[model samples]
Target: MDTHPLFIIIDDVHPILITELEKSGITCHYHPQITRNELLTIIHQYTGLVVRSKTPIDRELIDAASNLKIIGRYGAGMENIDTDYAESKGIVCLNAPEGNRNAVAEHTIGLLFALLNKICIANHQIKNGIWDRNNNWGQEITGKTIGIIGYGNTGSTFAKKLQGFDVTLLAYDKYKSGFGNEFVRETDMETIFAEADILSLHIPLTTETNNLVNRNFIEQFQKPFILLNTSRGQIVNTSDLVAAI
Candidate 1:
């Protein structure tokens, strides 16, 4: 009986992961486009599984992975995986929480700049031959107040990225404290609502946070503000958000 591990990667990842695992004598089967039904049929054969946001690792999938010893998420947020049940079954759940922190932070900054400068709107207008400079006059970030929710990897990185922007930064994390620095003032939701000119979300999706941002939440802001969400879409109620906008 060979005790060597057999791994199945059901999502597209960097080739380096495959090369490194194969170097350690582990056999890898890469099926980036495997469907749920197809995965169910073959999951029992492997001892390790690698996934992204594509599949839901619920009870049904876990039960099918009879030989699964470990489950590796290629990104942060284990919300898609049934981590509790997997742990109970002696399965190790792993994730690279910091893998794309910088990337997400930079992307958030880019989106903020775009929104403040009306870049997308201007581009669309230009393409349609409607370039009116007066209406498209952009706002500057230098004097704005940015409110960041969730002080985790991406959140902290984003705060760091805004250091030299000369903007007042207020961050609120329900589960964290004492992370305030020279650039970011660790504060509460009320202060954020009162002062923020821009709001950004970087939290995960969980039962407690599902539809966390609805009409009532939106109405709490003291003034009109730009909203940025880099987290899970479910965190904000789509219907409520659309209606609010």
Candidate 2:
């Protein structure tokens, strides 16, 4: 009998996590680009499996992993992992969103500032020797009603970060209640649709969120809204967003 604790790995995970796993006395196999079809063939031999967002961990994959006890996700968003099927099969699913949240938040803020200040255009135009200061104008975020679609970890952090700017913040999440604060106003979708100058999407993609933003969704707004989507790409309708902006 093979007594070694075998882990069917994905890519390189955090050294700390790897050290801890090795400390527990487990032998690991690294497969940086293991396809779903390939995983199915050898999954029955593995007890622990680690993956990122390369492939979907659906019911078929779960059934293939008869000996799989735990699945570890390297990054944020477990939309790639089929939690329902995994849970039904008594397999634990976990992810590391904490490692990447700060980076995502910082990038979002940087992009917001650049988009709001026209910094990218300024830099590009100045490099081309066309510095017309009067023609180049920028808008301030102050007093602008900014609507946040989801008030989870990232959304709440962004709202708190933007509070010093004095921008009116509105947050709406149907599943949650009482996320309001002195800096943020908790409201419904209707109020957000009518009031927000810039709308930021921080919602997770799921069965209900395959195409959350569409023609009817945008038509609710009476203003030309600046939409920021640093979360999930599919949450915002790419074609409709392009046309609206």
Candidate 3:
């Protein structure tokens, strides 16, 4: 009997993870550009799988993975995998949200800062040899209310990053309770809608989240808010988001 575990990575991942797996005596195969049909043909050989957003592990692919014991997603999102069906077949699916939470939090803060300061607009204007400072006065982040939807790894990391800033933080997660800390106040959606000057989404893509943000959702906000969505693109209807702006 072959006791060595075989793991196939169908997407690009950090070298450290692959190195660590190799050190553990697991045979690792890195195939960043593996096609769907190619993957189906070679699926039965691996005991474990590593993936990112490049491949969709649908029911057909899962059915072909006869020896697949586990599937590891490099980042937070696992919408590409058929988790329910995989689990039903006793295949454990996992994700590394904690690994990139800080990076996501920092990048989100940077984007929010750039938007609030009119940095992008100013940069474009400057590049075109136009400088009108008074007309492009930017908003200050201090004293602003930031409402975070989905107080998970990324959300909590963002709240922690905002601790130094003089801003009010509110977090709401339907699946959670008592998640509030010194940096965030646990609140309901209605309160967030009424008081948030900015809203940030950090939820995963699921059946309940498909087109979660729409025209009606935007209209409920008491004031026009700077919306930030670092989650899946499908979570917000692009047309509705454009109209909201």
Candidate 4:
């Protein structure tokens, strides 16, 4: 008798993944809208699992996956998945951190330009028949100090994108170092806090990073700065951010 591995995909993914997996004799069963209760009912039947950020792969779900061998996260950020618990059960956890690096970097640049130029505000005013160009004057990024936290995939790509601009780039990564180049200066948080005119966060959400940007963190900056957060929302304290704003 011949047996094949069965994978249950609970989220929508590119069709190429299914095609490639099927080519290797792996059976892929896609249930993009399956509920937690429904998944729990038949989880033990599949040998592999795939998901995006919609559901949390918690202890209960891991326990229910009796025959599960691998858990594939379609995107970055493993906070939604209980990786430690899954690994304890000998299940391999995987994620595509670099999959959307360019997309995120480009979007961050678009947001930066929109914020500096007040594009959204201007658009809204124009739509409402209130064209106030005098008050909506924009700032230039030519000589601003840009601070970047976390110098991984998206962070490095963002720095690369800013190379053409005549702005100072300072990046700090607690887990990495010695990556300084012509465009980016690898530095410390103290220097960034003292010099940065624009701040960007690219780190993942974890116990230490949860609410990392609070009132105290915001107050350390020497100047009022524009903040860009493309990572998890939980990394910033909502009330504190509102108060700061």
Query: Which ranking of candidates, highest lDDT first?
Result: 4, 1, 3, 2
Model 2: lDDT equals 0.84
- After superposition of all CA atoms, the RMSD between model 1 and the true structure is 1.3
Residue lDDT tens for model 1, 76-178: 9899999999999999999998999999999999999999999999999999999799999999999999999999999999999999999999999999999
Best TM-score among the predictions, by candidate number: 4
Cα-based RMSD of the predictions, in order? 1.3, 2.1, 1.1, 0.9
Model 3: per-residue lDDT, tens digit, 1-245?
Answer: 76889999998888999999989998899998899999999999999999999889999999999999999999889999999999999999999988889999999999999999999999999999999899789899999999999999999999999999999999999999998878799999999999999999999999999999998898999998998899998999999989777
Q: Give the alpha-carbon lDDT of every model.
A: 0.95, 0.84, 0.94, 0.96
| TM-scores, all models, native as reference | 0.96, 0.90, 0.97, 0.98
Number of clashing residue pairs, candidate 1: 0
In model 4, the worst 10-residue window by lDDT is 1-10
* Model 3, runs deviating above 4 Å: none
Off by over 4 Å in 2: 1-5, 24-26
Which of the two, 3 or 4, has more TM-score?
4
RMSD (Cα, Å) of candidate 4?
0.9
Q: How well is each residue in 1-245 modelled by candidate 4, as lDDT tens digits?
A: 53899999999999999999899999999999999999999999999999998889999999999999999999999999999999999999999999999999999999999999999999999999998989999999999999999999999999999999999999999999999998999999999999999999999999999999999999999999999999999999999999998
What lDDT, from 0 to 1, does candidate 4 have?
A: 0.96
173 Cα displacement, candidate 3 (Å): 0.5
